[model samples]
Target: MGDVGSVGLGSLGHPLLGAVVSLASGGGVLLSGRLSLATHEWLADHAVHGVMLLPGTAFVELVVRAGDQVGCGRVEELVIEAPLIVPEKGGVHLQVEVGEADASGFREVSVYSREEADGDGAAWVRHAHGVLGSAVPSSETQYDFGVWPPVGAELVDVSGEYVRAAENGLEYGPVFQGLRRAWRRDGEVFAEVGLPEGERERAGQFGLHPALFDAALHALGVSGALAGGSGSLLPFSWRGFALEAVGATSLRVRLASVGAGSDAVSVLVGDESGRGVASVESLVLRPVDADQLNAVGGAARDGLFRVEWVDAPGAVAAGGEVASRTEVVRVVSEGPDVVGEVYGRVLEVLERVRAWVADEDLAGERLVVVTRGAVDAGDGVEDMAGAAVWGLVRSAQSENPGRLVLVDTDDVEGVGGVLPGVLALGEEQVVVRSGVVRVPRLGRVRVSGEVSGGFGSGAVLVTGGTGVLGGVVSRHLVVRHGVSRLVLLSRRGAEAEGAAELRAELEGAGAEVVIAACDAADGEALAGVLSGLPEGFALSGVVHAAGVLDDGLLTSLTRERVEPVLRAKVDAAWNLHELTAGMDLSAFVLFSSATGVLGGAGQSNYAAANVFLDGLASWRRAQGCRVCRWRGVCGPRPVA
Candidate 1:
């Protein structure tokens, strides 16, 4: 196939585009390039806060060059989402994609790149997306720069121009310092920019060399318009950009405000002889900080972590072992591990915890809850029932600190030697791996792949939907995840405070809202709510946010205090799990707690209830059931 317009790949191709190939599946072109300080040495001179960045002008140049490749020479619109940081030692691979023209003769264009060191399988980071229009001729008014420093324009001091930029984190080296002089008149700023002698020789290779193009924009700072709030500003969005002429070593640039109180500006570019070179209808800039630039490539690697088991020994004095108390009460997991016996096992642990906590006579003694293979500490979980027991005791321990201890062993015999040492170590949660005691620790993890948090098209069910946390989750589902259909369940339903207003707000945002009064802990009530969903709005996700707290010290607790908390957390979660087991669900998120995992003082019942959720999630995963496929979201409230 012939190359589009005057754009081609090798000798006749652009210096930035390494290859241009028509996509096999789609009728469009995909342009690929490799960028590096070593390959593009000029890029090394353009550093922000000592961190090198691919200038936004480079994206414009790349996009325009791509437009030429597809016969779409006009950039109708472009928005830069994230910065592309080039590492000091390695390089980055980039792609410019142009889709087939639509009925309006416009094509969708996007720019993506990834670190070259991350290998071929690394996820591409999307930097910019925009539209490309037909390569039609324009009749926009052009400015005349033939007369040196035109009639009424006043010259602005350019002595401290580069110094001020450097103070704002823009470190421009020789090649990038293209602003020779600037002028101002009637709220409009005009400037003259040109490439260095060495770089000028290669200026014909690009539509407009990024350094020169960037220097032209730097003149905007003369009016303090582009000097962003708190940090330096950079171009974020561009519209109506058309390259009239290429290979211009020197440019006369005009910068005019789009409107009153608007930071956006219009630009007109011309060669040194005053001939029109390019025009931008409007360009808006956004403030950028050092962190954002440094963390650009971290999206694929962010939000990633893993649990590690680290050895923690007792704090023994020099040449002496820590004294271990001889008196220790042991509570073992006696629940059956039958796949269908989750609730039964949970109830047994609940009763045991209640009895243990209520025993004021034994309050002076430390109760050690021992289980085998309850935690995934180096080895896979063997006993799900025991894991559930661990959850229950964790809460009880939290309510009565120093009164309870948790130990998970690989075998019953392994606990004999490690039990005293575990107690002596002062670690509340310990797992015996091959007779060595180890505790859980969280560690950071980095992976190479795009992170997507989008939800599919369907209805999402949120329990306790009228409560504070539930209301927050409902709004997030509709606003952030684009959940169009929501079924909210609460005891009072619409009668709950702000429930009616929330429904209206969600409905205003194009989501169909259903607020029904139902007790999630009541299996039959929950079933009725699910069955009553309007047709075509099938449930695809569930957020079990319903929870009740009746916190108290173990000595002040009773069945009444524990039952309601369990019903809301334990029973409700189990009911949802059993009810949704056969149904296909994309997510079954149980809003559990950190208190359940690490135990919280005075919240034993609530903690135990949460731990049951942890076990249930594990059980469901083992059964290949969809409940809790993703870990539960834990927080008292969502950040604004």
Candidate 2:
């Protein structure tokens, strides 16, 4: 063998090096010889962290060559008789039996630098592998490759690129290993990174870890040019769609940008092949410099918040998409008692106005009551005789004519004390504390509002009646809870299949299944659908499950994944809420997931998208809307 580190013939080097060299695995014989020397020296220096040597001809040669230098009689015995030997002084080392080595070829190898020897580092590596393995296509074949550094080696330098290069080439580099590799793709991005096959099998099932998802988002910032050269950070929203469960071996991701201007959206799709998968969409805000972030106390201000338009017009007639601005305001509550008192006053006014409208409209000639403190004072009322109260009455005037009445009382004893006498003669009346009015009589009146704090029927209009999850939830509702009617809302251009499916599933369930396909996401379309509902219909529930899951990681995910999913989940939810905000409903079941709670490794981009669902749930609940955060888990069957 050549001198340790020097490639040549007839050169003497360390015995350990010679043994490493003698076996020609790849490259030139001389090159192999030199590498053997370098490997042995590297292992011996500072004691290797985790290195396992399998029993074979090469191993035997190494032992024979070590001879007297084997140190410790115990080491010699381990080399000679034991099926496996661990170098006690160095990192843990296991010498596998020759038979075992022969049965399975080397899979992949993970060489960790000395610095990554701690438990946290190990955990990170393991998590990364889970993300990578889960994304592999289901059709790939299995192979065994060597994993270097073994289990005890302290990783001095751990790189995703290095691992990929060792496995195959630069093209095969795993994206999740580090930030560098993840930022390469354009329009969309994806990566497959993880522990070798054997290692993955050893680790068991892994959930999507938040670190990995965050890293993917970081990579997206770099790839999409969202991150400025000065390293400023931007705020964004993410919506994720869960497709399947992910497990060990490989991971895949796709990414892309959707929308534009100050509020841009990025989308990411991730998969674990035949296992669990998901799609995520992130709404990114304008970049903020470090100084600005610091001034805000490391927290983003509310004004910069973007309110995703719910059922807002998509792509205005001018060709640009419509966006909504969101502002966060902080209100200091004096106390619960004060709050209650304020609300009570407001309700009392509203009730009085309603009563007045009902009493005036009894003759039923489209009576409009404009009120100013329980007296009609506004000129907006066309018919003064038909109006119950008159004279520019700002306080008693209804906000909407023929539909509302307002009665304001300065003191508790001013207008019938706490119970003001407001009458409605004909039209439906809504009363307000400051003012009230009779609302216009539309052909159909749809009641959509939110309900909280109880187990009751919640109404949700499903536009795509035939969709999978939509059908599932609807069936469950009617069969499990005896729901009276399931108004299956769809677009005017919806396919006939949807109506057929709804009829087939709900025919005899006593639930009136109305199939109307108008873009549920469109405010006008939704309004029309609501107007068409039968009289006396009261919605008790709403389930927004209409969505799609596109597969791809951060780099490879595209607008195809980002926009539709966002429109379906975030935007759709908002629109549905707007259409039903005034109606009575008990629960709003938002299908969220553990992916949002825990981010996926290679699926960093996708996981970020799903997190927005959690934010939505919190926001709705704060508004007194009963929101359910559904976290889906997987596995074998077990008795409930």
Top TM-score hit: 1
Could you tell me the lDDT of residue 564 within candidate 2? Answer: 53
lDDT of each: 0.74, 0.34
Per residue, candidate 1 scores C-alpha lDDT tens digits across 301-369 of 454566678877553222332234333334345444333344455566566656765677766566677
The number of clashing residue pairs in each candidate reads: 1, 141
User: Global CA lDDT of candidate 2, please?
Assistant: 0.34
Tens-digit per-residue lDDT, 81-170, candidate 2:
111222333332111111011122211111111111222222111000000011223322121113211233222222433333223211
Candidate 1 lDDT score at position 63: 91
10 residues in a row with least lDDT, candidate 2? 124-133
lDDT of 2 at 327: 12
Write down the TM-score for model 1: 0.55
RMSD of 1: 10.0
Candidate 1 Cα errors over 4 Å, as ranges: 1-304, 310-365, 378-389, 392-403, 410-418, 421-426, 433-438, 450-458, 475-482, 552-556, 627-640
Clashing pairs in 1: 395-604
